[model samples]
Target chain A: MTRDELLTALFPAGCSIQPGGFGTLRGMAELPGTGRVEIIGIEAGTPLGIEGALILSGHVLDLVAAASRAPLLVLVDTAAQEMARREELLGLNEALAHLAKSLALAAETGMFTLGLLYGRAAAGAFIATALSTQMLVALPDAYPSVMDLPSIARVTKLKLETLEALAQTTPIFAPGLEPLFATGAIAEIWPPEALAARLAATLAAPPPRADTRDALGQARGGRKRAHDIAAQVMAQAAAHG
Target chain B: MNAPGMNAQSDYYYEASARERAQGLLDPGSFTEFMGPQSRCLSPHLAQFNLTGAFDDGIIIGAGLLQGMPVYVAAQEGRFMGGAFGELHGAKLVGLLRAAAAHKITAVLLALDTGGVRLQEANAGEMAISEVLRAIVAARRAGVAVIALVGGRAGAFGGGGIIAASCSRIIVSGHGRISVSGPEVIETNKGVEEFDSKDRGLVWRVTGGRSRALLGGADAYVADRISAFRDAALAQIPNAPPFTLESLQAEQARLSQRLAAYGTCRDATEIWRQAGLEPPAPVADLSEADYAGLSRLPEADHDAR
Candidate 1:
């Protein structure tokens, strides 16, 4: 879906979104039945990178520090982070880190942080912005993964057909919202039509902060070792103490 | 300088393995790995692809003594999948930070040697790193100093770089490079003119320890030797400041000033010049001590702090 269409659907009452270069969108909008909240949404086709991320995350930090403690909603739709020489040279990782830190600071300040993944949330873009939120929801149509199949195939030196066959049985190598949901990376796979309502409910009563994705992944049989590894580390730590 | 009774070959931080790095950084014989390779806690995701996984999932997390002070240590093994964080790898990091916070460990030293989240398990890896960030913040809130040392072949990139930033302090060696995206990724997407991935010198100049320090992204620059890293880590851990609103504000101001000053900069040389430094000696030629002597974060009012 286009940025305008998604924003309109999500905020029917109207939102103030301004498009920046490289598919970046910035602005603020009020949550349904709640006070004004800050919005940093990246349209689906946008190729997010260091410069765009800095602008988006800067706004988040500004809004969080503002007098109003309105919740912050991060709209994700980017396919990948811009892989440019200038960005890497300029320390894209640091820019991405800045974004993560901003979101983290927002959560630390007791501001409600919600992420709505509506499109392709892949790799670095997903890590920098979306994953840090207190509550993260994905639309059914969202394609969230680290790297796409072709890229994965290239990196692993495996045939695309082989990876595709593997993805069919294991969500581990699959691309889409369902596989992500199986891993518990996504809190819910809400339909596009119900996004606004779901968001409203989320903002009204933000879920308590906890890292339960590991357990959820275990229960779903997608990520078997994460929970157990974390448990072992904790247990060992306790034992040492 | 080699540690007492250690071979000279192990002196270099870049040459050390993740386990060796962890053991060498801590006081002699003080390192007790929590889930060492013996634990067999490998990445299940890699197993699905029929790939052999490291027993510790590429990261070593445990408790140890730094200068006789109780501390926690976590080091990433770059040889294992470029030290990437898969689900299990990332979980171990998050678990370590969380434990450090709970135990109120006096300090936590992280030896970062990854290119960021493992692409195979991207979402879970990202989530794990995010959890680690939260835990780092929590540890800092509880007065536990969190320091990151980046000096491995992979350096620190992608989510790893971000995680390093979130730490209370960052120490980098001359050979270490830290950035979000790798050079090859940039070259593939932006064309060779944008960033020639083959030009190692150019890559280092742009994202190397010297540039990161000058850019206000790193706190200290040390020699490529493990002893230097240990010394720098020791110097900072004892009195590492708590993460407070005021300190965060100061950091925010510093970062903002960096963007304002060098946001438009394309060349690392120009950045150094603009930051009021002399035409920099080749970044590769500068010793850690020499780099440390140079002014860092020139845009910020360091004296005020």
Candidate 2:
């Protein structure tokens, strides 16, 4: 979908957003039932880097300093952080950390935060921005992964055909909204037409940021070991104490 | 092995296993590992790919005492998959951090030596790390000091790097390196001329403890010895400030300044000079003590901010 289409679906009543000076979208808009919120949106095909992370961080910092407790709406659509010589030399990790910490601060302060993955939410960019939210909702077509399939194949030293065959049975190695949803990384995958209404409901009553995804993943059959491992850890701690 | 109460005399922080590091950092006989190798909480994803899974995945989590103060610790095993986080490993960390906050632990020490998310379980690893971030924030909100110690050979990179930065305080040994993207990835994408991943010296200058300390990414620099790390953690954990709006605001400003000052620079030395440390000491060559003596960013006054 085009950027305008996605924005309209997210904010049906309309919102004003301008270029965030780094190919990102940032602005303020009112939700249907919830009060106004600051919006930071990354375009679908663009790459995020130091500039983009700084823009997002600046917005979060401003919101925290403000008297209003306006929630932050993060719309993610980047494949990954920009992989360039300049970005690496300049410490892109620190830049991304700033963004993550800003979002974490916002969440800690009781400001509702929501992440809507409209397109690609991949790699460091996903961790820096989208993963910081209290709740994450994705469109049916959203693509989320640690790394793309080709990169994964290279790192694993496996044939693409073999990996693809494995992906058919396991959500762990797959890259799509389905596998993410199965793992409970995404709270829900809503249809594009219903995104605005679903978002309003989620904002009104956001889920607590508890570590329940592992259990959810187990129930969905995407991950069977996470819940058991956590259980063992907790049990051992209790037994020792 | 030495007696349970006797601290090993050698510097084992770099070569020791995750459990050994945890045991060495904590007070003698005070460490108690949960979900250890006996629990067999290995990664199921690895088995599917015909890869062997370590019994504890790649992390060791438990409660311990640091200088007599109650603390929870999580140390990643660098030898096992480069300390990557998969579904089980990430959940283990999340559960431990949650318990730390709930139990009102005095501090939470994370001995990180990772290259970030596991590639075999890409989606699961990413999600697990995300949950781990949330848990760390919660623990900090509860007034628990979350300290990250990056000293192992693997250092911390990718998602692990971001998690390290989210902690209340970061202490790195001279050999530790931290970055979001590994140098090899950068070299592959941007060419060797832009960033020679094979040049260990250049890599260290870009992401090592010294550079990270000078750039305001890390809070302290210590020697490569385990005792040095333990001492640093003891000094900071009890006095570390809780997460507050003012402190976060200050952090925001500091990061903004960093981006503004070094965004265009192609060399790590230039960043040191921009920070007003002209005639900068060679970061990789300087002793940890000398590196810590250099001029650095002013400590954030959470209350004053």
Best by lDDT: 2
Docking class of 1: medium
TM-score of chain A of each: 0.93, 0.93
Residue B295, candidate 2: C-alpha displacement in angstroms: 3.1
How many residue pairs in model 2 have overlapping backbones? 0
Off by over 4 Å in 1: A18-32, B1-9, B238-241, B287-293, B297-305
Residues B1-305, candidate 2, lDDT per residue (tens digit)?
12222456566578777887888888888988888788788787887777999988889989887777788889999989999989888889988887777777778899999999899998888887887877887888888889999989889988888888788888897778888888899887778997899888888888888777766677777877777788888877766756776766776666566667677777777776766776345767766566666776453222211
Tens digits of per-residue lDDT for model 1, B107-212? 8999999988776776677667777877887888788999999989999987788788778788887778898767887777678988888998888888888777
Q: How much RMSD separates candidate 1 from the native structure?
A: 2.7
Model 2 docking grade? medium
TM-scores across all candidates?
Answer: 0.92, 0.94
- iRMSD per model? 2.4, 2.1
Cα error of candidate 1 at position A17, Å: 3.7
- The per-residue C-alpha lDDT of model 2 at residue A28 equals 80
Query: What DockQ does model 2 achieve?
Result: 0.65
**lDDT tens digits, residues A44-128, model 1?**
5577776677777667766766744788888888877777655665667666766776777777777788888888877778877
In order, what lDDT does every prediction score?
0.77, 0.79
DockQ of each: 0.53, 0.65
Top model number, TM-score:
2
